[model samples]
Target: MEKFSTHTGIAVPLRQSNVDTDQIIPAVYLKRITKTGFDDALFASWRKNDDFVLNREPYRQGSVLVAGPDFGTGSSREHAVWALRDYGFKVVISSRFADIFRGNSGKQGLLAAQVEQSDVELIWKRIEEEPGTEVTVDLESRTVTVGSLTVPFQIDDYTRWRLTEGLDDIGLTLQHEEDISAYEARRPAWLPRTLPART
Candidate 1:
């Protein structure tokens, strides 16, 4: 996971609400084994329309996504988060997000910003009105700023700390490596210990 303190980039407004996991990456693309190359599969169906927000110029290169209410609402596929990251969006702002999707986003270093409905509309307007304008998402200050409007958002303290530190579950565990190694050294030899790697 990457540290997310502050990010400033073009904002793409996705007006659709209730975007599901299947629509996000589509189940067809899930068969691939790799975790980081799902960009082409993101919004795969919608992109075919040629006029989808993500398929348009400027918005196609946006790194920040401003979406409508109930933005991420559907299944618990972590691939949805992966697709968004691979598609180059560092932050996704919306009025509401499904709990599962929000959790996945946090673990994968994608900021799922929850704001009021009015704020979501305001941000969407700004992005759509100024196609290539930049929006700044500051995790430290818990705010999203674009043009003359700035809105504050809420995220749990622990998740915020983890994101700012760039520590995923594995990264957090590795921080206790010294203690883990010490405990392993003290283990008795007759406890049916596991074998070492064959390498």
Candidate 2:
């Protein structure tokens, strides 16, 4: 996964709140095995309207999503994060997020920034008024900035460290590679074997 110290891009204002995992990529689209290529499936229902926020210009290319409170509120699906990432979103801003969804996002390297509801509305107003304005999300600074306005966002210290360091679950595990290798070398052959044991 890529490091997420700071990301600046066009911000898409998703006015609706309580956006669930199903609304993100629907269960029908989960058939694909790969982590990517789900871009087309993202917001499948909403995108059909042509008037959906994401279907609009500049927003179609946006990498930062500023959504209302209670975002990612439904089922726990890592695919939801995958869909957002595949759709080119590097960060998602919301006042509140479901616990499971937030966890999935962190593991996938998607920065889920929790800002106050008032700040979220302010962000929406800025983006909606300018329509294509770029917003900067600085993880290191723990702030989201649009034009002259800047608002703080909160993320756990551990997650912030992991994201800023570009460490995912697999990356975290690999940090102890030498220790794991050494331990495995000391294990008895009788413990287990991929290949069948000789009779």
TM-score (all chains, Cα) for each model? 0.85, 0.86
lDDT of 1 by residue, 2-96 (tens): 89999999999888888888899888998888888999988899999988988889999999888877777887888899999998999998888
Best by TM-score: 2
For each of the candidates, give the backbone clash count: 0, 0
Against the true structure, candidate 1 reaches a TM-score of 0.85
Model 1 CA lDDT for position 83? 92
Query: Which residue runs does candidate 2 get wrong by more than 4 Å?
Result: 171-199
Report lDDT per candidate.
Answer: 0.89, 0.92
